[model samples]
Target: MCGVGGIFFKSAEHGAKTGEIAYRILDGIYRRGPDSTGVALWHDNADGLLYVGVNCEAPGGGGRILEALDQLGTVKQATDGDGYIRAAIAYGGSEEDLVDAIDALDPAITVSSVGRHLEVLKHMGGVANLDAKFDLKSYDGRLAMGLTRYATESRIDFTNGQPLSARAVPGLAVMHNGHITNYHHLRSSYALKGYNFSTQNDSEVIPIMLIDEMSKGATFEDALNITVDKLDGCFTYIAVTDDCFAVVKDAYAAKPTVVAENDEFVALSSDPQSLREGVLSDIEVWEPGAGEVHVWQM
Candidate 1:
């Protein structure tokens, strides 16, 4: 099992202290997933922007990822570490541009949620290490979500970490709890459609499925409903977009998910304690029904 928590602010400049909020919330759930921690912060900008978490392994690996980014275009800032680098890239670039840039330096690297309003950053480490290395303690943004992983199906590396994104579709990111038993079959089907999967883990298949539906003109809600209907196992998933947030539970609802909201924000997590610390402390909390779709506006 993993811990996922997030808060959506009404404005990009709301002075919400997102980093501290995320830290407290995630720290509260540290015991649920002590293996690694990841966070994705989103804010509104005229240019459209996203910040992703990166893990670097080679001596100059972080620099190499930055160098490649320079060739692609202007990058705001980048943070590097033993095996990861988190950076911000300008939106509006073609999918090929980003894929080629990251591939040129490290084909093993993955860029998540390449959308106008979503940027993801995640890696393998504890909350304190991630905060210190990435300066998450001071990060301020409009919308942010964080995950601490326990590494169930996938290896404990950046590639198999939480907060997976849809590279071709900006402003779309996903965090999940529970397993997808039908992953292999779904992967095969998507492979035939020219969609490449980066990890063998079933969670990686989610973004591809949602992205495909969204591309066909389905709204985020529509896409999610259709996707959840097809899923064959116990699972609860939270997906975020620039303007919307949704939580989907399988027919069995075997996994846990708590949702609470107010006029200011909407929050969800695998447990109530994280939500208590992260977003609202006194709001009524409830478990979503099986085969339910909970949607809210940002």
Candidate 2:
């Protein structure tokens, strides 16, 4: 089993609180999935600058990454961490092309996420260890989603972690629990259409599928509803964009999920205990029905 948690702040000013609560939620469910931890956050970026998070393990990787970024556009800021680097770039080109250019630098370097308002950080360990390395509680954003993975099918590594983003679609990321039984079929179909997948994990398909549907004129909510019918799996997932946070489940709803909401914020977790541990009082809690789709906007 895996654990997933998402919190959305109704007010944009609660950036600090966003990081604190995300830590609590992950801490509550770390036992369910101690293999790896990942978090993705979305905030306000009015200037349309892309925040790119990448993982590089090669020697002198940080310098190489920065040099690559310089070739692409103006590097506004770059910060290095353990096995990871986040760069803010002012590029007036396509997000997809930017990601592709960075990905070609070295096989050891892959763009974890790239969006105007998104930042993703992940590690191959528990939540506390991840926090110790990156000080995750200090991360500030408007909405956030995190995952503790059990590594059922994919290799246990930093790149295979959850909170995976779509290469073709900016400002979209997904975290999920439970397995996709027909993942190979779906992967083949998308590959035939020239969609590239970075990892072999099943969770990666959710964001790509959503991007495909949205490219075909489907709304985010409508794309999720269509996914319930198209994906033959017993999974539940949370997808987020710059201004929206959404939760969806398959027809079976085999994986556990609970949600708590109030006027200030909405929180979801793989189990109710996480909400209790993460959220304060005065929130209404309930379980979403099978195949339900709920969305909240920031």
Candidate 3:
């Protein structure tokens, strides 16, 4: 089993801290997923720099990455966290080329996200370990999603964690609970089309399929709606783009999903206690109907 949570601030003035709340939510659901935890955050970036998230474990990987990125453009800021590196680069270049260049640095290197407003961070172990390394409490953003993963099929590693993003679709990230029944079939189809997946986990397919649909000119919401029909499984997923936040459940709603909302923000989690613990205490919480989709745009 896995635990997923999302928080979308209704206004920047809400005075909400994304990282602190994300910690509470994931910690509340720690028992459900004690193996690993991750988070994807979106914030306003007026500087026009692309935020690139890469997983690199090679010796001197940080220096190598900076050297390579400087060859293309100026790297404004880059920070290391465990095995991940988040860099802000001012470059007018193809996202594919940037990611490919980074991935070629080492066999262990994988680009998790490249976007204007998105930063994906994950680590094996508990939420505290993740916070110790990335300092999650300092992040203040418009929307963010957190996940605590319990490995069922894939190996328990940094790259196999949730909150996976599509390398081809910048500013898009997904966190899911439950399993995808048609994962292998979908993986084969997408792989045959030259799509590269960084992990063997089934949840990784969610973002890949969404990227495929969005590439065909479907809006983010339309792509998600189409995904609901194409995927055969019992799952509840939350997704975010540059301007939107979405939550979706399978037709049967076999996985648990609870939501809480108020004038300031909206929150979702696999456990209701997580909502109460991370969000508001005296607010009402509800569940979406089977196959239901809820989206909020900024």
Give the Å shift of residue 162 in candidate 1: 1.4
lDDT per model, in order? 0.73, 0.83, 0.85
RMSD of each: 2.2, 1.8, 1.5
Question: What TM-score would you give candidate 1 relative to the actual structure?
Answer: 0.91
User: TM-scores across all candidates?
Assistant: 0.91, 0.94, 0.95
Per-residue lDDT of candidate 3, residues 170-247 (tens digit)? 888898888888999999999998889888889889999998998899988888888789899888999988888899
For lDDT, the strongest prediction is 3
Q: Give the per-residue Cα lDDT of candidate 2 at 288.
A: 88
For model 3, the superposed segments whose C-alpha errors exceed 4 Å read none
Model 2 clash pairs are none
Better of 1 and 2 by TM-score: 2
lDDT of 1 by residue, 1-298 (tens): 8777777676665667787777777787788788888776776666655454444544567777777776776678677755667666664568656764575565666554455557676656667877787777687876677777878888887777778875455667788777888888998998999887766668888888998988899988999999888777777888887788778898988888787777666666677887887764667888999999988777
Alpha carbon deviation, residue 281, candidate 3 (Å) = 1.6
lDDT of 2 by residue, 136-161 (tens): 88766667789899999898876788
Question: lDDT ranking from best to worst?
Answer: 3, 2, 1
Model 2 stretches astray by more than 4 angstroms = 57-60
In candidate 1, position 38 carries an lDDT of 78
Per-residue lDDT value at 239 in model 2 = 86
